[model samples]
Target: MAYLDPRPANPAEALTELLAGNERFVNGTRVHPHQDAEHRAAVATAQRPFAVVFGCSDSRLAAEIIFDRGLGDLFVVRTAGHIVGVEVTASLEYGVTVLGAPLVVVLGHDSCGAIQATHAAMTGTRLPGRELGAIAERVTPSIWQANARQITDYDEVGMIHVRRTVENLTRPGTELGDAVAAGRCDVVGMFYRLADGRVSVLAAESAGE
Candidate 1:
């Protein structure tokens, strides 16, 4: 038997679905969608994930669980601080170009250890090893940006990092950027509130009419 997915076809529709799922999560009335056995078998050979969720590797930032989505609902990519690099960019591009995902979401969270460490590193309090330092370097700009605005909060820095990540993805000349320019997809940055279980949209970049 064949199964069909009712996932959204365009970027705007995909964003709406994600927002609705988040609402269900916040209300604690989550009816987790698309996790049944039949759904699993249907997607074994092919997947039609609607959105590409690029988020942090933090334990609490589970994309499917937090968004109330289930099997084959999202193509997820995660890294510490959700940093961008060649691999990360290539993976996200594959999700949009090859998998036909319409939406790419950059998910960040409050009280993030990465942001905290970056801030501490900038303030001369923490010096991470070479490997971890690379991650800190990627997140350093947001810390600097926050400090420029006299913001001392780590959550504010984390939000800035999220927006920066989305901007990096959609910047001119990149594959994702070209796609967005051509009206093929959208990139959104969001902050997840650890205490409230809510995801707030920070920035959305797409081809404008």
Candidate 2:
């Protein structure tokens, strides 16, 4: 894969590549592509990752391992609840604009501690650590949204949060949004199943619209 010419020329192709890799992982037929020492050295000077994955920081959500991709295949961003703060937004912007990635994946998983903590906080529990509490605070809106819809299950709440994150990233006027609007990128919301090691698409924008 040449750094100058990226593979999976379109968003659909990029998304397909990730899905195929995840299938390999799920079937335990992982090829672990691009991780050889030679490929690692080849990408050291430059990287042209095809997708930018913004997913929860859960241990089981390790992007490369689960996606079965090796070096320079994905530019990954992580937060406790996969929160999209300024830094996360900027990093993804760079991945798309600077790195020229075609696809952005927003992944959330089941049994997320951040979701649980946010739910607890909503139920009147006092969180101890200031920074940790702040993380929960960011996730509070999703909890509220779920509650408004009478959805109390943590995994369901996680799906709502992931969908919200996808909406926020692709909303009008943002850098990511502009890219999508111009037919330069595609944003997909995905939910990961820890039990089965599978991924399901929750939301997606086709061809930027």
Candidate 3:
């Protein structure tokens, strides 16, 4: 079967499509023609992705593969810890405003190194360089909150970060916020388990207009 644009009118439907696709991926029965040359050429003319995914830059967690989506099917923005930086925000803006994507998923994963490093920093463990420090700094607030709750596991910490990041995207003046408020987009958070290949959605509320 060809890769279909499953951009549903209801935000909940969009979420369902993503979850269903992930189920297909976990079962090893992904749909076809997503990466083919013919499909690539067809998408070269114009693209109409159904959803925008903001995920971590972890090699083990590929948004397309995890969602069982093909090229041009997802407008993906990836960064360390799935941080919502200016550039990442801009990319999501383009995806939502320009590409007309109806769903935005902030995808974090289990055992994320970024979350671990942030936890270490928050716990007074020295980080090596400024580069790593930057990542730690971005994630420190979530780490501190998780630490306050006595959550030590990397998976728990990562989930905290995912929820915080999704909250950040929903804040006013953000592209995600605007799109969501206008009832044109939905912002959701999810966690991908590397071991079991399951994606757990953290939030289900629609970005109400």
Candidate 4:
């Protein structure tokens, strides 16, 4: 593994690498790659992470541990609900355009408190603070979509949120979208299972698309 290549040739390769790592984690066979003293020194001068992980701030959703990835493997950004704001977009753009990351992964998980809170807010429970309400507000669309589809499952709402975030990031006018258009990157949305520690793809778009 070229642990220091920020650009991994193509999106498929980068996505595959992440999924493989998740598989390792699922099977309890993680090799803990790129975390040793030597690899640490190798990335000390310059870092070249291959994927940018935009995920929720849920404690159990720790990107590196959940994906079985090590240092210099993933550039990660997190928010309460993985809500995409201006700063999120800018950070992801820097990862793709400046760091040359080939893949962006939006990871949502089952039993997400954010999703539950958003659902509660939709069903008449008020959120406490303006800031937290804002986070819940951002996640409300997914809950609404789920309700429109007659799906009341919290995990499914989380998946919808993941898909929406990926869509928003890769939409026509965004920098991430431009990178995808230019064959420089791709975006994938996935759901993490809290009970089993596995990941499943919910939405994806490649440069080929």
Candidate 5:
């Protein structure tokens, strides 16, 4: 079967689709679109997803489930704390620059263990391993940014990290940055409430700055 995805015209409609899906999820009326065998096979040949969701790797934060998207709707990338490292940067560039996705979402949530550990380490508790320490190191700047505003809570810090992440990807000279500069893409930072199943925008960088 030829799966026909009339791509969103721009970032605004792309975001609307995501928010509407989350509303469906929150209201327990998920349609669960595009999971059939034909859709899977169609996407296997070529995927033109509308958005790239770079989120925390928490089990409860499944992008498709929470956003009510199915195969080929989203190009999803994830990391603990949703860190934007070299690999992640490349993946996002692939999604927007190559696949032509118009929107990039940085999704973070409350009660995140990664943000919690970063907070603990900031408070002088040592991270258990070299890799874990590196993760904390990447998260340090966000906590410091939060501290400048007197915010010490993990969820608040996570929001700060997500916002910082959006800024990084949309700032000048990066791949996503170029895309945004040329009015081809937008980057948005979003926060998810684990208990309420709601996602809200924290910060955004639309096309042309």
Candidate 6:
């Protein structure tokens, strides 16, 4: 049987599809045989990715594998801790506004080195250069806030960062924000576990919920 395209009219269905894909992956029942040369040729003509992903640059957390999706299925942007910088935001805007992706997932992962580095900096432990320090600086506020709340677990820190990135992207007047408010796109946050390969969504108000 052909797989049903899970591009629902609302974002919730998009998210559900992603979650179900992850479950399939964990259960070792992924269905991506179409990623071969024949499928690649077919997709060469045009692409209609259903979702936009902003995720950490971790090697183990590739969006396609985790979500059990094939080529031309996702527009993905990766950076450390999935931080929302100018270039990243611009890429996501293009995906939402031009590519017509219905959902945007800001994905963080367990034991993220970025979050750990930020925590180290917030605790006044030295990290190397100005370049590395800049990343820590960008993520420090979230770590500090999480720390203040007595939450020290790395998973929680990563989740907090994901939530902050989502909030930053969804603020009013921004292109992503406008897309979300107009119901043209949705921004959701999730956490990926490196050990078990499970994804836990962070936002309570998921699109179409």
Give lDDT tens digits, candidate 3, residues 3-54: 3444466668778888988999889888853688777876786788888899
1-209: candidate 4 lDDT, tens digit per residue: 34553446678999998999999999999999888888888788777888999999999999999889888888999998899899999999998899888999999998999888877777777654776888887998888777887888888778878988988898898899888899899988989999999999884434442
What candidate 1 gets wrong by more than 4 Å, as runs, is 1-3, 204-209
Assess every candidate by TM-score: 0.94, 0.93, 0.90, 0.92, 0.94, 0.90
Clashing pairs in 4: none
lDDT to native, each model: 0.89, 0.89, 0.83, 0.86, 0.89, 0.83
Where is model 4 poorest over a 10-residue stretch in terms of lDDT?
1-10
Task: Please provide, for model 5 over 1-209, each residue's C-alpha lDDT reduced to its tens digit, 9 standing for 90 to 100.
Answer: 46566778799999999999999999999999889887888888888999999999999999999999999999999999898789999999999989999999999999988888877887777554777987888888988888887898888778878988888888789888889989899999899999989999885434442
* Model 1 error, position 116 (Å): 0.4
Record all residue pairs in model 1 with backbone atoms less than 3 Å apart, i.e. clashing: none
Q: State, as a TM-score between 0 and 1, how close model 4 is to the true structure.
A: 0.92
**RMSD of candidate 6 to true structure, Å:** 3.7
lDDT of 5 at 171: 79
Error of 4 at 180 (Å): 0.9
lDDT accuracy of residue 70 in candidate 6 = 86
Clashing pairs in 5: none
lDDT of 2 by residue, 1-209 (tens): 34533478889999899999999999999998888878877788888899999999898899999999988999999999999789999999999999999999999999999999877777777553777887887898888888888999999999989988998888899999999999999999999999999999885434432
Q: TM-score of model 3 relative to the true fold?
A: 0.90
